[model samples]
Target: MPRFSANLGFLWKDIALPDAIRAAKRAGFEAVECHWPYDFSTDSVNQALNDTGLPMVGINTRLGINGIDDLGVCAMPGREAEAKGYIDEAIAYAVAIGCRNINAVAGKTGSTDEAEAVYRRNLAYACAEAAKHDKTIVIEPLSHRAAPGYHLSNVEKGLETIKAVGVANLKLMFDVFHVQVMQGDLIERLRATLPHIGHIQIAAVPDRGEPDQGEVNYPDLLAALDDMGWDGYVGAEYHPRGTMEQGLGWLKAYQ
Candidate 1:
């Protein structure tokens, strides 16, 4: 069976970061990831992970100028400095917590060559800095429906950017939810992008709720991951339909 990682960003949003990590452990998850755990000290987070022996899989960079309203600024023109600052901060935090992947948010921008150029340049820098610490930089493609104007809005764009960056440490965050919304060929896409993928996330499409409530068949999808020899953890990144525990029945299949 494939290992599963609890995404504290959604799974335990009401609790403290350290407690969330502990919660994930008690729930039988092998690992944990988060959207933003910056509010908590790395020491606290480290302590929880140490106590539970659950690996911190990955974390996302800070949002852009608009904060909650903006997803990121890495691909936004003229915000290169801001983007790098977020990248540096994320890397430092990830290192302190022994986290493996740093997600470089692409932010919102027009589908222009300049935006792509800026994104590529920033990714190159991020990859170089992260590689120094033996950390990987992963970028995800947000669906146009969920994040309108987001620069990296498709897997093809994300893959192309990784290739253009030409760095081994840079890879794609294959988020199943967004990919299903933007494109439907999940297995084929996974086959094509598997080698370049650093992490995988899953949630229900359309509603973004519990995995079992989605249009996609997660059991088959996860089985496909196993057949493909993927050794990485699949992040359970989704909001609970009710309480976190009440919606976790879907996890039993993998356990």
Candidate 2:
């Protein structure tokens, strides 16, 4: 069976981060991941994981200040320092939490050419620094509908950035929801990008809801992952249709 990591950022949103970890544990999740757990003390989150014996599969880098909607500034011009610092912070947090993956989002930019240039350079630096700690750095493609001003809106752009970075630690964070929105050939794209993929996330298409609530057949997709030797966590990242527990039937079906 495929290993599914509950994305605590979306799940258990009404509770504290530590309590969410516990909730995931009690819900039968062997591993978990989060968006930004920095609001609370790092030690508190770490203790929750320790108590539950649940591994944090991954965590994302700081998106940016409010109002700007900067999901990640790595691709923005003149924000290289901020981007690097955020990666440092994420790496420290990942180290403290015993997680090995950190996904970075590319912020909006005024210039696409410059953004790609800056993004590649910043990604190379992040990969180098993260590699020192034996950690993986992932860049995900968000759909324009989901993130209107985001820089990398498709897998091709993400892959181009990865190639330009020319580093082994840098990889793609493949999200099924976003990919399905931008492109429809999930299986072919997955196979072609398998070499550059570091981690994966999933949610229902069209509505950004649970996998079972969407048009995608997750059972076959997950089975494809196993057959293709994708030894990474398929992060359950989606908003609950009604309750978080109700959305887990898809995972249970696979198991």
Alpha carbon lDDT of each predicted model: 0.90, 0.86
Residue 237 shift from truth in candidate 1, angstroms: 0.6
Model 1: weakest 10-residue lDDT segment is: 246-255
Model 2 residue 24 distance off true place after TM-score fit, in angstroms: 0.7
> CA lDDT of 144 in candidate 1?
85
1-255 per-residue lDDT for model 1 (tens digits): 779999998888998999999999989999999999999999999999999999999999999779856689888889999999999999999999999999998877776899889989998889899998999999999888988888887899888888888989999999999999999899889988999999999999879998886689888888888899999999999878898879888887556
lDDT of 2 by residue, 102-181 (tens): 98767877438988888888888888888889999999888888888788878987888888778899899999999999
For each candidate, C-alpha RMSD in Å? 1.0, 1.4
lDDT of 1: 0.90
Candidate No. with top lDDT: 1
- Which candidate leads the pack in TM-score? 1
Q: List the pairs of residues colliding in candidate 2.
A: none
Q: Give candidate 1's error at residue 83 in angstroms.
A: 1.3
